[model samples]
Target: MGNCNSCPSKGNCNSDSGCSGLVPKYGKIKHIIGIISGKGGVGKSTVTGILAVQLRKLGYTVGVLDGDITGPSIPRFFGINDKRSDISQVGDGGEVKFAPVETSMGIKVMSLNLLTEEEEAPVIWRGPVITGVLKQMYSDTEWGELDYLLIDMPPGTGDIALTIMQEVPLEGMVIVSTPQEMVSMIVKKVVIMAKKMNVNIVGVVENMSYVICGKCGEKIRVFSKKTAEEQAEYLGLPLLAEMPINLDLVESMENGNVEDYVSKSEEYEVLLDNFKNKIGI
Candidate 1:
């Protein structure tokens, strides 16, 4: 039986006797990032989308593995309408394999939204089944030669989140949260969880910390006055960036085109730099 020390898998191998959930590496992936939040509606998926596009802009081959199985929105954000995952057969016995779908910006993506006939269909799956799908996507999907593979993990310290922390070979994780006391409290839980799992905490992102008034151009703290500094200090991690609430960004998300949104926004342009510097892209 292989212990953690003897395990060949460079990724998180939660099993002592070699992880049976180990996904075969089909392509060359340089870095794997997990974007997580303590709760939903903190723009975790939005950050994932922004990072993917920004990295691609910086001339890196990037892909996103939508780990949020129940509420897969990566496909929607990328504006991919393909409802089917490409397949291939291996060996004489005809073992089937799944190919990740590509976006218009040449970003590779794989999500449950593409597999389901109805995008709005509820996953309605139990814990084990959801985790099994995540492992399958990691093992079975062909994400060829990506410099960065960002995983859009579901919110909270749930089963899927734990499964990913235990399984995926995460280079690091970026925690997303708003500038609210409750949100900051929850963010700490995620940070602690990452440390316990031996996952590197890259940094924290404060989403919707404030908004710019149209008339006065003043920064308004719509959510809370808590700064990214406080959150970072709480997590004992660096504050990567603090994102303001923008109507244009909201529109982009609503239209399922965040790449376009980030390209035009001056704020995200600066964020791109901060992100690159922190993660050493």
Candidate 2:
């Protein structure tokens, strides 16, 4: 029998007996990758959006599961915040399934923001409710045939994070952090948690590692340059990419046009290449 750790039955019955129900019945996802961080404001969601767009551009079908239920931003980044997912009944038992909204570039996305009446409304639910919603979003959404499904996880090792690590069949995880020493220090907690859960750590992405001076066109290291490298080495993981603070990209995301940025930006070409190589895509 296969590992029943993620099965809804909690391993009471053998998976070979056809009692397992962990994998989403409606989706054939080739790879499920979680984008996570130890703390907030580390640009984890942005990284997720960029990766989805880049992967789609490479002719691979991709999907984004906004696992950050309380602070869902995947829809906004992909310009699908105003759209609602379509619900339909499927199967002999009449099981309800949600059709994920597609972005301009055709990347499927499912998020709490898409279901809510107002995007600005706060998700006031407690831990259990939030985790339940996350599981439903993963299992109930009709993701179709996808090469990659990226889960933009909430920050920290909390209830939602633990639920995903425990229940979701995550192929790997990409840890996001800034170059600040404090952030790097906190990111170690995430690495430790992933190890404890027996999840593969794909690598670390150092976001906002530097900024470019507009007048001189020089790369300025805002934080210590060695922090991310040192952190990755300490965690025994590869440094996937050192992303600079790009104002244009920020503006693009703010405008809900991340696909445009991915296509037009020459700077992100290196990031895309590095991420693809590290992810083995």
Q: What is the per-residue lDDT of model 1 for residues 97-172, given as tens digits with 9 covering 90 to 100? A: 7888887678989898888887888999899999988887876778777788899999999998898888666778
Candidate 2, residue 235: how far the Cα is off, in Å: 3.5
lDDT of 1: 0.81
**lDDT values, one for every candidate:** 0.81, 0.83
Each model's Cα RMSD: 3.6, 3.9
lDDT tens readout by residue for model 2, 1-281: 32343333344344465533347767677778899999899899889988888888889999999999999988877777889998888778977888899998999999989888899999999999999899888888998888889999999999988988887767789999897778877888999999999888888888898888999988899778575677678767888887888888878877987798787767667667877777676
Q: Which stretches of candidate 1 lie above 4 Å from their native place?
A: 1-21, 81-83, 92-94
Name the lDDT value of residue 105 in candidate 2. 93
Residue 32's lDDT within candidate 1 is 83
Q: Estimate each model's TM-score.
A: 0.88, 0.89
Which sections of candidate 2 miss by over 4 Å?
Answer: 1-21, 89-95, 225-227
Error of 2 at 192 (Å): 0.6
Ten contiguous residues minimizing lDDT sum, candidate 1? 1-10
Rate residue 113 of model 2 by lDDT: 91
